[model samples]
Target chain A: MRNPRTGWLLLSPTLIILLIFGFAPFLYVLFVGFNQWNVFSADDGLVFNGLDNFRRLVFDDDFLHSVGLTARFAIFAIGSEIILGFVLAQMLTRNFPGKSLFRIIHTLPLMVAPIAVGAIWRLLVIPGFGPVPFFLDRWFDLKYQIGSYPDQALWTSVIMDVWHWTPFVTLTMLAGLSAIPKEPVEQAKVDGASRFQVFWYVTLPFLRPVLLTTVFIRIMDAIRTVDEVWMLAGGGPGTRFTGIYIWRVVFPRTDYGYGSSISLITLYLTIVLCWLLFIAISGRRKGEVE
Target chain B: MKKRFTFILVIAIALLANMSLVSADMHGWWAEAAAPYAGATIRGVSESTPPSNYVADVLAAQFTELTGINVEFETTSWDQMYSKAINDMEANTGIYDFVYIEQDIIYSYLAQDYLVNLTQFAADNPDLAYEGYDESAFTSFADYFKNADGDLFGVPMEAFVKVYLYRKDLFEDADIMAAFEEEYGYPLAPAENFDQYRDNAMFFTAYGENMDMDLWGTTVQGSTGHPASTYEFLESIGPSFGLYNWGINLDAGSAMSANGGALDGDTAVEALTFWLSMLPFAPPEATSSTWDEVASSFAAGRAAQGWVYGENAAWIATDESRSAVTGNVGVRLPVTAPGVIEAAEMGDGYIGYYDGGAFGVPHSSRNKEATLLWLQFIGQSSVQAEWAAAGARITHTATFDDPLIAEQDAKVDGYYTLLEEQGPLFAGAPPFPFHAQVREVIDPFIQRAILGELSPADALSQAAAAVDEELSRLGYGM
Candidate 1:
């Protein structure tokens, strides 16, 4: 019924690019997931092993441990990022002097590359040589090496993630806060609602969609955390995050088949988790409407 | 007038002819062989070590001048180099004409047929070999790059032995020695055995504490989450305790004791325990220290001793700007448990780790002939002395007697002499095609042990079991 030729012409470039870069690679991954492929094996030419690789995943303790670490990292990092971002957004939304400058300065961390962030933090936290250790000793007398000790390495990485990404969440929330209807706040005040009550009922409900979106984006991004952790802690001291674990399997180990399976598993889980979150949020909104 | 004019003209003609012949002689056989491939661009990738940097900066320019083939040699990190090279080879992409193959990965490269056999290539194309390329001049380290049939695959570029280095200033201090003797009932000196090593570590650590100095007894390559920590445990500490070949029982081809493998055997567990014991004596950064950090720590005078790579020895010993303890560093064979040498000699173990890398033409190379000429050009004996001096890694037997190396031996406190005399006691990693797989399974366990999440015995036991399971899955144990 529509002009199909013009529509196809308009979408061809993007579709082709996506097919070449994104879809093709995903299809290849799916294909390889069912085959036994080793990059270094001369004898085997992508031998089809069906579900063997997937079965192997069931008993892979290292992989399971990495999943646990990744989950913990996500909960702590994303949770902190959201709370700090909301607070900063609330503060910045008020009319104030040099508000633009403060906003710009807060976004500076977002401009730097994640790997550079990791490297800078590495320098800051090095024992005996770094300024951080010197000040900590002078003030707190705590002799903690942030990226070395098993107990501290993962948390240090989490703090770094928060520092890098909290600005993004703040920016998103700020946009949402600006678009909020002003009448609700006046009505709340006229009804003698306390500041906390107004915020809980009016501000939070209006910001729910934005908060859900930010959380989803962050959770997905957090699952793909590699560059900073690789540069700083190297997924070490028993903090082997899942992303680096898959990378080690694929590249270092050259077990392409198994790596592809793990990749698919990660992709499947991400999709399912995101879908569940979306459905739950939708259901809550429906209940509120009712 | 006619006779004088004729004589002057003939002399001028003769001089010009002689200059042309001299230029041709200097160009050498490689120039003639590469004449057809002139102006062709070839690419390579290698780790950004001093030696590789020298090759990229100095040798590539020289080779381009001599052979007329332009070489764009990328000096990159170890991870990127391996990834790019392997990807190119796997995909049959003619991106890299040549690749650096470390001793540890040569087995995987050969097993995969990713590399062209240099011996066969030479035999097939005698015209491509450089005039000065004598294979016999290469040291035994080159054997690591050869196949079971005694055919060469990669051209050895840099070879060195991992060695023990101590701060002479701390060992000879009278007060420290007296304290050590009173406490441990032995004179404080460069360690002779594991026991002495441990005692010295404990004493120096305590001594530093008493002096209120920010010092540690030793530096550990114990980045608990990196492959470097695993390498330190497997190569440096494991060999000294008589756990050879990564404690893998090759007789049964499994790492599990149930399959007769010794990966978690008594000797390996003991070695792992001893290695972890040094963690407390090591600087606080031990769990984050890689080879580079370890070298930096030793050079900064944060540690009394370290198992330093030979590549860093010359710079650490002579570069005053980098090394705070310049001229006070002493190099020796690592202190080993008793019977390690004998066990190595009797063909059951090794004393230390021999580490190096070589350049090989890949099968995917579009310009194999030109790349071959380039490899042979660097492998020439004439260039060995300069490269060895700059990189502090020698791969030729004749280089041991080179005047430049002799000069550096004195500068590095006889590091060259020790390597020349005791290099044979060391061995490269076993020829396992699944090297990265096995190491990945074990590396985390080592980090776990370092973090005290698992005891040494438990870590090794779990690691051995995991390795066995992996091996069986990969069709080894079956």
Candidate 2:
């Protein structure tokens, strides 16, 4: 904090790593978007094809469908996660018996890797071997088949996401809730302010920034989710999100130029979405202050 | 007496020296040829299938011990194996010395010149060639990996057909057979035609329901999300209905009947419809099942019959630890439409897919010579019998006669016998350099059809048109 030179030198390693691994690939991908490069057909090399890839993306129904599907998925998954997370966070803020144990148990799903979560859910839902189907059939007399039914597959993915990331949202919200000042709440209670009125006026405003940040992070993560969904469904009928679709194009099809163009478009869409979300939330907060 | 003893000792010494020379001729070639690359480590990547696992765990270790050249083989999921290998080769990274070239994808690899010409490599390095490893020893399956000029690109590691598997116990049951005969008005047996197959599926499904048994009539590899579903419909189901070469006429470069392709023909629609009809008789998991899961479903006794990849037949039939229906499993050729078998016999069409893969040295490989030796090591006749037993695959004709394979054949209900006798009826994927590109475009339509988002007839019509557009984009049939 004292000397600029020392600070610069200390930060150089991290900067170099970010430059080499992060920025370089991003730049390369951007460059690749303007060319016609089939990774398998290397003999042709990277031929500059101008806006052809972009033009192709416009007409590419699969890419468009994937983008729309990803948007819908992010909305459902992040919305559920945020609401559940906030409620859990509020409950955890209170003094309760075995609070530490409860917190640990509630947060366990957050520790599971995305790929492992997909594998676990896949095992749980697969008809014969999975217990979920067995229990559903036994208890409700309903035949639960995620593999055959697209609706079931899509909702199962949503549920899996909620199960996996709600804990992370809860943890973040819990931290924010703990940091909220207690003096105002106590004053409101002495003045005979109702619990709901006091909480809405005081706690909500305090947690606004934390809520926005959590929503932003979860939105980005949910949009880019591939591993869990792919493992569970292989981007099958209902769960072919943008991440899996892009992977299919780039890896299986090996159409680097088209894949790159689609990726760049997705990136722009994600940025715009986050920006709109930020503006709306921040504008609301500013209006309240006014 | 002393002179005679000395003469006899001298003769004995000469005979011992000659025997040592013969011994050196038989086995010393590997070490002597591999001397230059002793400390060099050659890396390979393959799908984590049984054959590839054997190569990774058993053959690699044995090869290292014999030649002193370290073998580092990485076996991963099917998708990762391909992406990793392709990325390395395309980037010219020299990361993998060899990669698995599946029979279906060899055309693409060859078209890109991504693989080293193994036949030429051996000719160029005569001393490095293993005497026992002759290309001629391989079965007809090896021909799939050859180029137009008759040069081999890959060494065949595994080869098998997709065969129809049935539950022998159910088929042989006195009550079940009587019930089946009464309903279908025919002797209850393995299906010999499409109608019989359908009837069997319906009967068994109802029979299970009536008897309060947990069973389905068939396993449908109809996953709406994965390529396995496309493979099932196109390779297994379509071909059984007499639609060959994915119903695409490569010569005309079209998938539409209007353009001379059979993709949207009545036969293809009939095939798709029949396959969809079986979905009700298949277990709930059938819609989500890949080839792996189909094998599992059969092994778990969830399906009475199914079209299963032969590579899984051995384990599902004999490995009691994994298979509940081990002893009750039976193998036979898939039921074909009328005239389909004749066409296959005449070598004009195929009944089903003959699926397999070979390990080939990449052009980008830094250790081609060393990798070549490793390939030859696995391709040797002496290794075929055990490899065949382990993987349920046979690349060499001689493997069928091997005592180990013969023993395995009986255990798997003479699967090897059927393979040897009927393999000619099955064919590898058509030699299309645009295989993946075409498959990608057509896959979604098949998926849509399976999920009932599109009718089978409509799906094929749209898919055929899409394939035409794609093929045209790729500059085919211009």
Best by lDDT: 2
Model 1 regions lying over 4 Å from their true place: A40-43, B1-24, B28-32, B346-348
* Tens-digit lDDT track of model 1 for A29-120: 99999998875544447899999999988788888988888889999999999999999999998979999998999999999998899889
Per-residue C-alpha lDDT of model 2 across residues B188-276, encoded as one tens digit per residue: 99999988898989989998889888899998998877888899999999999999899899889899999999899999999999999
Per-residue accuracy of model 1 over B253-340 as CA lDDT, tens digit each: 6886777877798988999999999989998888888887898899988899878888888888888988898898999889889999
DockQ of 2: 0.55
TM-score of chain A for the candidates in order shown:
0.93, 0.95
Model 1 has fnat of 0.51
In model 2, the Cα lDDT at residue A59 comes to 90
Deviation in Å, model 2, residue B373 alpha carbon: 1.5
Task: Pull out the clashing pairs in model 1.
Answer: A236-B225
Model 2 alpha-carbon drift over 4 Å, by segment? A1-3, A39-44, B1-27
